[model samples]
Target: MSEPVKVREGAAGASDDKPGFDLGSGPGRLLVWLYGVFTVAAASRSVVQVILDFGRAPLAYVLSAVAAVVYAFITYSLVRGGETARKAALVCCAAELAGVLVVGTWTLVEPSAFPDATVWSDYGMGYLFIPVILPVTAMVWLRRSARR
Candidate 1:
């Protein structure tokens, strides 16, 4: 098998000849953790929406379901690395950012548009702002790993 790349600070900082693999490599693994969280949140929200009141916020519920699927896809891409997957993940992240922004604005401007709540409703206020932070982090990481 081929050797793995050595990770250091600043992408060109001092290099250490430490052999073997470093668990710290590959997007710090916490990304996967966060993605897992999003998966659970989106999936659960969609399920509850469908069960409790699917007819109330059909569009919002559909968007939540879409978000859940996108989150799942991103998790898979991150876990299984490849150029295509990475690119697709980036696109998904970008789309997620757009979704949050648009939905947030709509909720603020037209509260009636969403009779109930979706993942992006109120900018994910119920989720303690993680929804706002996640997409930004994804974009940053994508920029950092753009070479890939």
Candidate 2:
């Protein structure tokens, strides 16, 4: 007769050295996906705008590209899932929130300056405000993960 196999605690392919933070689980998963989507969308849009209409609205287009880069980095950090990555993401999210507020206000106050919309123009009205909301949510999630 053969004995039944038994699995040990923390031995089901799990590691005791596992990170305490997981920024890609549950709601964090959604945040990562949204950031990824924004990365692609902003990057592609900025590329085309810079290529064809750089003279028309250089500032707005450059901001779009910058937003894309930020989103990409945040997504990567969330997926990396560690204390260091979480801290990096937290800082980036704060910066992203500040950018959205500044750019949104700038667009509202100086409509003539923009002449075209960036991802964060008017508090991300063009993207249904996802650009504005994403960072705030990410910041909260990152903070929560750090506590875990």
Candidate 3:
């Protein structure tokens, strides 16, 4: 006689038996770590710039703050590891990509508009383009993780 495994309840009355997928495992772990790093980096940069010289490049500093928020949200969603979290991460990733593209283009088109470069400027040229590449990779991973 074998006993049945107990299934725990998750957030919003969802079953823990099938928690969508583990976003904190395997490559997703790397994504989470990278996002966490970016969150800290962007946040720190923006805060210092805003405090020291916000008037010098208000657009750039504000955009960096926005990037930090987005990065933090994605990091949280990845660690949460649920269907709702996955969807939210995917949407944020798309928005991140769009931000990168728009900011990169804007920086190139109007150099004077940004007295200082944002995290997304030149497609993250200052960061070796990781800012642009990360979101695409994350979206793919999030989509695949949902199938697991």
Best by lDDT: 3
Cα error, candidate 3, residue 75 (Å): 0.2
Q: What is the lDDT of residue 38 in candidate 3?
A: 97
Per-residue lDDT tens digits for candidate 2, residues 9-55, read 54666754455757799999999899999999999999999999999
Q: Candidate 3, residues 12-125: lDDT per residue as tens digits?
A: 765653446589899999999999999999999999999999999999999999999999999999998888888899999999999999999999999999999999999999
TM-score to true structure, per model: 0.78, 0.88, 0.89
Task: Report the candidate with higher lDDT, 2 versus 3.
Answer: 3
Q: Candidate 1: TM-score?
A: 0.78
Sort the candidates on lDDT, descending order.
3, 2, 1
lDDT of 1 at 38: 89
Model 3, stretches more than 4 Å misplaced?
1-18
Off by over 4 Å in 2: 1-18
CA shift of 52, model 2, Å = 0.7
Clashing pairs in 1: none
- Residue-level lDDT of model 1, residues 102-130, one tens digit each, is 99889999999988778888898878767
Tell me which of candidates 1 and 2 scores higher on lDDT: 2
Cα-based lDDT for every prediction: 0.77, 0.91, 0.94
